[model samples]
Target: MQVLLRGDWRQRLRLISGLILFAFATTHFLNHALALFDLQAMYEVQQWRWIVTRSWPGTIILAAALVTHIVLALDKLSDRATLRLPAWEFIQLALGLAIPFLLLPHIVNTRFARDIFGVNDTYLYELARLWPDSAVLQSTLLLLVWIHGCMGIHFWLRLYAPYRKFQPLLLLIAIAIPIAALGGFMVGGRAVAQMIADPKTFDEVKQLSHWPSPDNADRLAAMRLIVRLVFAAMLTAALGLLVWPAIQRRYWPHFIINYVGAGSANCTFGPTLLEISRMNGIPHASVCGGRARCSTCRVRVEEGIDAVPPATFPEAVTLASIGAPQNVRLACQVRPRGPMTVTRLLRPSTASPADVDEAERGSEGIEKPLAAFVLDLRDFTRLSQKKMPHDIVFMLNEVFAAAGSAIAVHDGWIDKFIGDGLLAVFGEKHGIEIGCRQALRAARDIDLALDHINAKMEAEFGRPLRVGIGIEAGPLLMGRIGYGPNVDMTVIGSAVNVASRLEAVAKEKGAQVVISHEVARLAGWTPAPELLSKVDIRGVSEPLEIVAIPRGRDLPASLLASIEDVDERVVGRAAF
Candidate 1:
């Protein structure tokens, strides 16, 4: 049973019901808005209700929807403790529960008794029972129902960007509609009472009880039973929708992979994975639905790479942003198109797969020296703001793609992308000398890649693209952090910060690439005479020597010669 709930179709059904309930509330509000007009307008609402109620299908639908919504809500409530809910959310839940209970008596008194049993009571008869004496309870129930519904709509609309802009207006409308309708109902009640006191005006209230009288007791009982059964089914479905996924977690515990095509994979049945993990007492992160929207469920396909399907649309979008390799896929999206083997790259939620994979491969040795490189796009903020959203996305995609490919080709691992910049780490398991050499070579490769990207963009957009890069060498701590399902692999220390600062200096000096004196020393290379300079970096008290490569130029022996003279003077100054 739990397994059935975890299935995608069941979840989809629940989503559809939720949408239906939202629609019902919207239309109900619109009907109540009629109160802003006159008593005749309120009468017209009753006529509309009569039309809907008389229709067999409409009656069945409404009954079922109400029952389903209540059941699902109650099921969710049972899953979590009341004490765990925030005070406001708990209050809302209480109000929602009260709505059906309070509404049941009123519905029976007005619609059911009159329409089904030939009670022949006017609208005024029901209004008089609740006015003034029962006013507080009536008003409270109305307010609770309205507020609960409006809040649900608010939450739903928040999920989409287009609706966000009109949120304030939507809220105002939600509040105002209920207030006006309740006020009008109260005023109409008073008007009806006044008319009843006078025999001459009694005839005016006669038409208010216009519902056709039922023919027999048997027919009436059948109608009532049908209504109850319909509502019961709807309520059961809603409750099942909310509760089944949890039940699945308790029972089903195996990971099932479905294959789609060649070189592509998706992580379907992740809820089952989560459930199995929990049953075996293994930790997993799925704060949201196990959807590919969040990259928390990332994994690396270790074997059968050729049998996996290409990335689906959502998976591709997220992977492209993070610069994930072809072999890496989010566990939520990698549905196996054919037979495949995969390892959970992200052992924990917070950790990136690349770092975890590296650690598992025994690439993190104590003696291994790493070189860090940072590449920042110059004038990205101003440029991005001036371009259209799609254009900005396209440009960033091209830049990151080229930069990431170049780093990977040179045997480097990208640590992170910092806004409009890229941070690549080299030699997590290699010697200091080799790390520095690879870092320098990667820098040159990135510069060349950018040139290719710029040429392509120049032809398309009639403008050149620009970026600045910096490289530095130093010892660092590298490992994984976090417990169980939420772990992350990253490097930390002063060396990382210095490398980032060097990138900043490169941007300020109008250079495409900058190398710190330490990196140059490790490389055993002299900078060109005109390519070396000293610049004061923020957070550093003294100026440091830097070798700059101008934009649209290739690194050469002359540039290395200038770096040597600049390095000598800076080292002497530091010694003094």
Candidate 2:
């Protein structure tokens, strides 16, 4: 345990160093935001900021954090065998690598120059030097650093209970602060440009910067040389990590990763699959950037699960919460110690095989035909207007209880409740035929359940409760929608919409249960020829044909055999 913690010290140090730097950067950006108010206010605030930051203890802490962060980052780059990263992580990495190059010049001219030459720095002096090209560089630098910091913080707190609730507010601040800073700088620069245009103000600014000194010119030249040398040295060190490992590959061992479902074999010398996937252009999802915060990138090891180390605390907690089997592991957190075959499990509940393949690039949902069942309690509105709120709520609870149970029994899900109505979907797992059949059975069962409920509640209500059930089975979209707080897993498309319209049609025509012709045909329930009727529906171009079934009991076995006979004749397959 001690050895494990010791080896993890580098990662811990990097996080702490990053947070300290982020704190400093945040304060600096906030100071820049003040420029939107008044340039003098910006300058005035800067004094107190500098007073705190430039103090002996502050200087030591800042310098130490900077060196530790840079050194540890370089070590990670060297240690890593693959360069695969999620889009945001890649962006953050690129920006982090660019920071020193953008920052060195500014740092040397101000922090170093102030210490060495006793230069009096002010807003006017900064404005003259930084306006135009330098302004763009500074703004880019600020944003890069800020974004990197924000990503780090997000990765750290993403799994925490409280952070998830307040994330929107954090996101708002993260976005608004940088924009305000950039705007503030532009406004301040405009004022400074006006100052420089006046000959008197220009001279004073130049004097403050100690310009025209052969000594100052030499110092500026020396600063540029130092920045170049530092950047080159860092680059060389990073490249060496990659080069040295490759040169020794023949002498060292390797690991083979067999993707059980992706239909491809891949090899990597590295430990982490998350990095290997990113580096190799394999489509994978890692919401927490490999920190094991969220389990969206989890995989089930088919073989050699024991070859990797046991789950760490974070991984264990996350896996247990989801009731993942012993074989399941987070791809980001697990780095195989030996060859392993694994399958990714972070897919939508209803995702098809094809959808899973495409979703590696992110969530591209599956489009399929499904049975959409829309059930609306007839005259619910009239009943609601007359009943007390509590009484109506009790009535609604009973309705949901009956409808929801029937949906579950038929292998369907209650999509949502609409006042006294409920929307359910079948074919989530089974194909369209069985889905439609299940819908028909569920509708019948719901009617029977409602009859039972009304029997017990006849004294409470003067009339029996009635419901209209509409069903349509056809091609539609099924997948998880949204990200962050807005995310949902459900089906969406024309079939769902048409099913909803059909429910209204049922209410309009005074039918207890109505199935679109498509569904009736699909479910193999060809009601007597005369039972089929026509009704106009919105979004559908022509008058829609439907079947009005009369029973509130099990669909006859003859219906299943008839449907199979039709399919065997047409598609040559008995589906149900």
Candidate 3:
């Protein structure tokens, strides 16, 4: 219900009508392709096609869909704040608008002639009339309709992952259907031309079609001309809307949209902030175009925020989902009703596949119970003080790689690499109990992996590298957070802070690993009573009871022996 409410009703209506028209076009193309088999086969399919399309209900439905689509298209055009559009969007629009003009003639000749003049419009009769002379026009019409419908379908489905995964297959089908239809059309036309060369066959086709009187034929031709002129006028009127925004900005009441740190755009009342940005060539990010389905186009109104109207239901829902402040609004959805200063929330360069995930993932930004693991390199300042910047970076990379592999072996997600340490979360899919167990196992593995690194680097550093590992389990809000390209999956909760504090405690006590009591209990591990101790942690009201291990190599061999090998797929999937 919420999803439906967030949808633009006009867009939904347009898609429905477009799909209906595309279905009609598909059936027509398939019927035409039947001509490859034989004219009799084409006739048989055409008859079945007409039984649905020529029926009273089908005719009414098709006509209603056509009118609805046209009216909504022109209405949307009239509402545009600028003529600027993405390349594919412009191409699709141009193709769609050109289709009606090309299609008018075809309809007037066949369906209109048959309905009004009682003309028997069959493949034999129409092919005889249109064979070689009007071949170019017919072929162009076929391509235009098919291309327009395919573009619409493409735009509609491209947001889905499944469509993108199978796009190559779909593209091949899109290409093959048109080629087959054109081949059938050309073959059938050639056959008609050969038969019509015989004067007897030509006369028979004309008589069989119940050739209309000269007066009725003239009337049909005149009506066709009149229909073409009217359609041309409508299209011209629609195109004329492009100039209205410029005219309004010059003479009508407008607003100055000040984009802090960039510039300002003088826009009329109708244009969205995003449209104004594009019109004036200001860079802004909008991964989902202006559909209000993604939050990338959001802007913070720094000044005169109260002057901006409230966000609509869809816009409000998106902002709320992202936990955006009250002053922020989607640049695409909000049309400035008054002068206001705004700041774009995202950089255009930050647009990426992650934005698509944000749009499609229903559980994005939700909270779940999980394990937070924090690790810190021991004596990191002393180790790096004597080394070159490049040398220090290389050493840190080696340490991170060892730690990262251990986390991965246990199905943990490496959230981010801190300067000398890292944060890893576990059990996004398997639950917190599994997560706690995985995180504890990963802690011991990290220590063991670093031992190998230490053996290699001991001669150069004069000492082995050491790290402090901390693990805590609790409910945490895990999701992507940060500005633009810096956005990353991270967890936030008391458990995260407690885990970090435990890492510090491990370094101070010279212990290889430290974990809150909750982690051990959740993982079902029973350490020695001597290793169990309590330490005061900042922000934690009570002293946290924890298990401290003096050496990672002595972290209970039974724990490792009892556990199964970690599933490779469990690692690096999500921040728990």
Candidate 4:
């Protein structure tokens, strides 16, 4: 058997249980859709529902998921340091707890009423009761459950590229399902109402409304009372959890926690710095939610540093890796033993590229594998020597605009601009193969786009501009570099170095686009090569065999197409 630690097991449990619940909801909604046909069709579908859901295997899974999910939720609440949460998160929590309350009566009257009281459970019966209530409760229940589940799914799968790509389609489906289900109910209810109103069908419709015996009514009343009492007890337990935090705050030693700079808040100890920041409506950044996975929430203890708690092992490791100073402590991990002044290190403003006040703020540095494309103007440096600075700047912007558009169409992004060239990366958000293909696509587009730029600039400069691109694939560190206002996204590794060196050698090799063997192999690219030669690249212990294209526009017609149809191969190349 495979062994799992505490965190692993808990995550697995939550994921498995959540999936089971979601499956049940999906089947339930599909059954609701059958009502649009007629009562007979709906009840027939309900039989299938019972076969799948009430069967021993399905019943065990459903019951286990319900218990496990609740236990985990309560466990998380009990262990929580503060009541602070993002609005969506808080809403999801509230909706999750209220679901059983709103659904319990409906469940009892349908399933239990049928099984125990000999009452018929059918689409007409449910819609007849629901139609009179204007479907207010049913609609509310459906919307609440759907919204909560969607939010959970988004949080779970947003990191995966496929999920993010299909999110729009998923959202449309989410919206349409409930609308169709509820609309079908309304339609079916109207049809039944019309039938009942006709004098000929009036008695038959009345007979369909099966009434429970007096004994059954008494039992139902007692069951409802028990449900209410149990629900009340659950609410009481949750209340106790909330009150316990306050009780501890009152009795425990008190210390004032101060937030400095923007989004400031003041709160008492009996909570972590992250706790006070979130609970007091301060926008603190905790990507891992105070899990010590990152140093994002680190605060510089400007004064009374010693008064703060010492660094835990996780905090120390994270801080050291990011070169944090001795005075800096992770806000999430720190629990002040005495009054301490601190500031949130990471805010949404710092994380955003569009913030007006902090527009220059760059993303934190992280290492990742990326496809690097370094393209250099063949003669722009020499051309700029004779031209005015503003003219050169304008010309370069025109060139970049064309090249940038080409890269963008294929999901590539410019990391930085060199003096007469640009460094771009692909697969920052996509997989490795896609990134390589994107680089090739960009190469072709860039060559074609240069003609447009040259057409605009030739009259002023008396010459056409040409560019050489080198595409290489390898492991690399990508992140915003530099301190203060000098920060910009940069790629650093053999991939970038090799691509840059290749650009430097393009003119000598009589090529406009050069690709490392590694890139060609990974992208499943194979063009009938004019020549394949081992060439010495800078910073490489061994010379690399590279494939050269005389011009980007002259790339093989099947370059991108082959990436999809061709099987993968291995062709290693040395670095720059």
Better-scoring candidate (TM-score), 3 or 4: 3
**Which wins on lDDT, candidate 1 or candidate 4?**
4
| lDDT (CA) per prediction | 0.61, 0.74, 0.80, 0.71
- Candidate 3 structure quality by residue, lDDT tens digits, 1-576: 233234478877887899999999988888788888888999998999899999999999898888889878887777777768776678888888888877876788888889988889998878887888988888998998899899878765655556778889999999988888888888899999999899998888888986667998898788878877987777778767866666767887877888876778877777888898889998887765677767777777889886778888778887776677788788889888889988776665535435555533422466789899999988889988888899888889899988898898887888878889898999875788778888877888887888789888988887899899888989899765664334445678988889899999998888988998888887767888999999999999988899998877777664563344333323534434
| Rank order (by lDDT, best first) | 3, 2, 4, 1
Reference-based TM-score of each model = 0.43, 0.59, 0.71, 0.67
Minimum summed lDDT over a 10-residue window in model 1 is located at 258-267
Q: Which residue pairs collide, candidate 2? A: 84-278, 84-279, 369-475
Q: Which predicted model would earn the best TM-score?
A: 3
Best by lDDT: 3
Model 3: residues with Cα > 4 Å off, grouped in runs: 2-9, 36-39, 126-136, 157-176, 190-197, 210-224, 252-255, 260-262, 312-325, 346-366, 371-473, 479-490, 494-576
**Poorest 10 consecutive residues of model 4 by lDDT?**
352-361
**So what's the TM-score on candidate 2?**
0.59
Report the Cα lDDT for residue 55, model 4: 87
**Which residue runs of candidate 2 sit more than 4 Å off their true CA positions?**
1-8, 154-170, 198-200, 207-212, 250-255, 264-268, 278-282, 310-326, 348-576
C-alpha positional error of residue 92 in candidate 4 after TM-score superposition, expressed in Å: 2.2
